[model samples]
Target chain A: MIITSKKAIMFVLSKIEGAVLMAKRGMLIVLSGPSGVGKGTVRKALFEDPEVDFNYSISMTTRNPREGEKNGVDYYFVSKEQFEENIKNGEMLEYAKYVDNYYGTPLNYVNEQLNAGHDVFLEVEVNGALQVRANCPDGVFIFLTPPDIKELRSRLVGRGTDDLEVINKRIQKASKEIRMMQNYDYAIVNDKIKNAVEQIKDIVKSERLKVNRVMPDYLDSLGDEI
Target chain B: MIITSKKAIMFVLSKIEGAVLMAKRGMLIVLSGPSGVGKGTVRKALFEDPEVDFNYSISMTTRNPREGEKNGVDYYFVSKEQFEENIKNGEMLEYAKYVDNYYGTPLNYVNEQLNAGHDVFLEVEVNGALQVRANCPDGVFIFLTPPDIKELRSRLVGRGTDDLEVINKRIQKASKEIRMMQNYDYAIVNDKIKNAVEQIKDIVKSERLKVNRVMPDYLDSLGDEI
Candidate 1:
């Protein structure tokens, strides 16, 4: 009877040790880039990976849903009245209007996801990304660019849908975006999808090793013993 | 005769290829830290592997050399007049006066070693590191730190060389330096010598892979083909 009770105690201690080892909080990664720079492709690759315990925060908007879009899954799809109310009530972190429609990020969902110990990624335009930084200064920012101006123009044209004038306008806009690249913490040149994704993964993995963010509190809680 | 001539051409091509593959450039890595952070131990371990091509850049001083010190190798041992003249002529990148003596980094030797493709390291105080940053903005800056305040004071007292009052003074000074930690580009906590050295090595290797610095101008020189 005594031997069995000792074995049960040992088993409980082992389980407790394992749980302690696994306790680690998640991070917030904010990815920003000019349009057509392949942020979506890289993000898609990350989403497909199982080892990463992270999720992209689906942004909420007041705009009408497009075909095949499901409410709360694709987006919250709130009415303009509700959205404006949330904005006034300080529920929206940042919001902007485009094409006569309102789009904004609901803060409650992001905070809930972060609290649940899952890293959240926000994929937004440069303006929205700047707003996120202003609100959450600790967020990591990554900027992406193409190999060169010619390649960027070629990629835009190769899409085969945009007219020549639209492509030219996009190219001009991209040039202006490139000028602001220096303000970013890190600039990734997306010459190849696979390599670019790998580089970004390395950055995120290495950032997790940063000393300041890694919890010294846990060590302190270990008390006078290891 | 024709066979011999072909063999000679092959040999020349192989030699040129080897030279291209072996081409390496030196870097200046400045390591700064708060007092009692164990940077010295990590630096010693780094030099243990001679193939790293790492050389510590010794600062020249106007102070009298200690017994058995070599003139150029240990320090430049410049006269006070020469040191002040170098400062006037912008030869000294950064300098400080202490105890009626002067210490400064000589610009010529550092650049000469860098041009010869050897990576130089400056183990300096935070103030000196900041000066280096201002003068040579491209050089890498690494700040070493302790795992926590408790560990830092423990290490300081564990040395057994300083009195209690002196240790307390150092602890106060260290906290001040730790507050300036964010000024550095990278900070590695010196928890253990081997771990810290590995972290530093990772940082150096990754910094070397920066795309903009490594992107050869030969691509542009190759004209529109790129």
Candidate 2:
């Protein structure tokens, strides 16, 4: 009778192990592109779509929040001193300073969410994305690109605020960023926001089903069953 | 004048090279699974769906053609002697002798289709798929799996034609085949045909966008443009 009960407990524990194996750690999907490539627009559309499910990582910033922006929602408002301290402690996954204000992703929040089996989405600039890659090499780095150089130049020029010299400089900067796409895992052409979102959705689905990501846990669960 | 014309011709050639680079070679997608895992059902559903675009590779067989089965449509019916000759000459990608009849995939046909930038799809038995993997290591090998061991046992018994002894034998064979799924690139659970089909569609889309597959050609097309 003792042996029977012990066997029963072992069977139950094995079943629980199988359940744990099925709940895989979530992926970090980084969306980045050159200036004027509409990365933000596509990301916003993706979040708004009901079919797209991901936890958006709100960035921590030292800049004063604009009107209608709430703390912890739009951004985690932090002081420059606190931000610098976090950076010193290696709490920032990626960060950048603009006009004397610091903007950064918090490593603690991303790790917490990912450990809980929730995918975290990050929208960042090209250089900032490279920094994130350095920190988290396994993150899915998707580089969004314009339909063509002509379209990219026109989009930059369409702002109608910059002079011809400024426009040319911006175009050159964009070209340099486009070249950085070779470092990414996937390059998506941002021709249509909906199409780009769909491609990204497919990418996430496929990534989840990847053998390397899921097989180790599965093999562990099998554990001599074969 | 000669230098000007020569430069113009070089420009045209470069554009053609870019076009050629854009047309990447197609992939070989092999779908295999244990018996009673419903691989055939999922493949049929995938092909029936309009969104799934792939050229199905018609197998060559020496078996007698059934009624209403047209040559080159269902399969390329060939004589046993010709099939053996092709096999001896290494023209077969994968082959098997079942019930005294030869069945195989023609390497030339698969290569012709793939080189023409058409994705080729092949459905084969587990052992036959292993043979294909040996011949084409780069193929996208997807293993369809039953949801669980109970479901697999029931599926084998559900045929209703086999007695308990035969059913047990089939279950044992299936367990061995299931172990082979570790060799595959992706293992999709066959819970629902529609869901499996959707996953496969995502896999194809994501595979097409893989960096390793498309990057070399894209870099060549850039040709120092960056």
Candidate 3:
């Protein structure tokens, strides 16, 4: 009995010690939202949140970015042929064509950030997010939408750049986009920007603690000590 | 182009309106830990926390109540025959015998609270927890361990009711329990009581937002408006 007690004590000590040495894997957070949902503003606020560490995934686009866009920072500018080759090699998480330009997530960069223990955030369109969903089902998929259609309409009208006709068109597209929330891992109603950012941050904290992410090596060390 | 945009807008509007009427299901949170880990203290703090809504699962036991213990509050005290009948009826989520006492969780109470939209918290042994795990895979399983084995030993010794031999026995059982933390959904190092409560509260917030929990009725209601 005494010997058994000693063995148990040693076993407990090893688990605590082993946990301290084990590295944590980063979470893959994929976000999608309709226009006027303030993705840019929310991303900025998330970056500033004190408790979170985020690594934004830069997409590779075949289309030239408008003014003030820098290559490799705003996006990794690549040729159409190169993009096609990546598609063939299964190197893209998700890709879509809009107005004759190609935009998609490069798997290598995302994998690198995740492997290096940095939470990678990718804000993509609905269709693109779905593709990423297929590739990384474990990834946290968050959908941001307005509280109601009236609020959405108000935001679109408030944008000022779009005319009444154009604003109407955008709102209609947004309605269709909102339905995709069912496919997301989480849906945040962006009624208040600060609350929305905090909600996402809270999600990051919880995902980091999932049991599936527990290190096998650390668990094995417990038995070794016994 | 105009017609397509209008149709898309109507489709989106209907989906959002549908979502407004759907009711959300409650979460099932299963918690387990080693002895002297302060489960009682943490549960008390969690109950008082303003942001969380918890329904603590009342366990059933075939043991006589100690001084000041009340039926239906501390435990649902039942006869050994009654407890065996419950086991025969498959009404228990988990049950185990210890020192001539039978203790376990009753599934009916847990399910009633869950269906009523209250997050239920269950504190059970590691083996009991695994039984619940098989019965309810969607349940969130959390484990609480001490900051170190030394602190655990000190707590067990400080109880004063147990002698060295009893304390040693308790510690030995605790080591086996600590190893079971590997199977838990999240493990909290309970160095401080308040922090443990907050961690659990954060977990509740995150779990409520999972995509699988979104209300289909609410999603359908949005389309009704269109």
Candidate No. with top TM-score? 2
Q: After superposition, how far is residue A61 of candidate 1 from its true place, in Å?
A: 4.6
Name the runs in model 2 displaced over 4 angstroms. A1-14, A17-22, A149-175, B1-18, B149-175, B224-226
Model 1, span B39-93: residue lDDT tens = 7677878778654666787788999989998888667898999999999998876
TM-score of 3: 0.72
**What digit string (tens of lDDT, one per residue) describes model 2 on residues B1-226?**
5455445435644674657656678899999888778987888898899987898888899998999988998789999999999999999999999889988899998999888889999988888899999988988999997664445444544555655556556555655665677889888888889999999999999888776676655454434433
lDDT of 3 by residue, B148-185 (tens): 44566556644556555776665566557666777788
User: Which 10 successive residues of model 3 chain B have the least lDDT summed?
Assistant: B217-226
Give each prediction's DockQ, rounded to 2 decimals.
Answer: 0.05, 0.33, 0.24
Whole-model lDDT, model 2: 0.79
Colliding residue pairs in candidate 2: none
Alpha carbon lDDT of residue B107, candidate 1? 82
Q: After superposition, how far is residue B126 of candidate 3 from its true place, in Å?
A: 2.5
**CA RMSD (A), model 3:** 6.8
lDDT of 2 by residue, A1-226 (tens): 5456445435745574666656667889999888778987998899989998889998899999999999998899999999999999999999999899998899998999898889999998887899999988888888897554445444544555656556556556655666778888888888888999999999999888777776655454443533
- Tens-digit per-residue lDDT, A1-226, candidate 1: 5455445434544554554555455677777788777887877776777766667888888788899999977688988889889989999767788887787788887888777767788777777788888888777677776554455544655565666556557656655666555545556777787766666666665565554565343243222321
List TM-score per model, in order: 0.59, 0.82, 0.72
**Chain B TM, every candidate:** 0.72, 0.82, 0.75
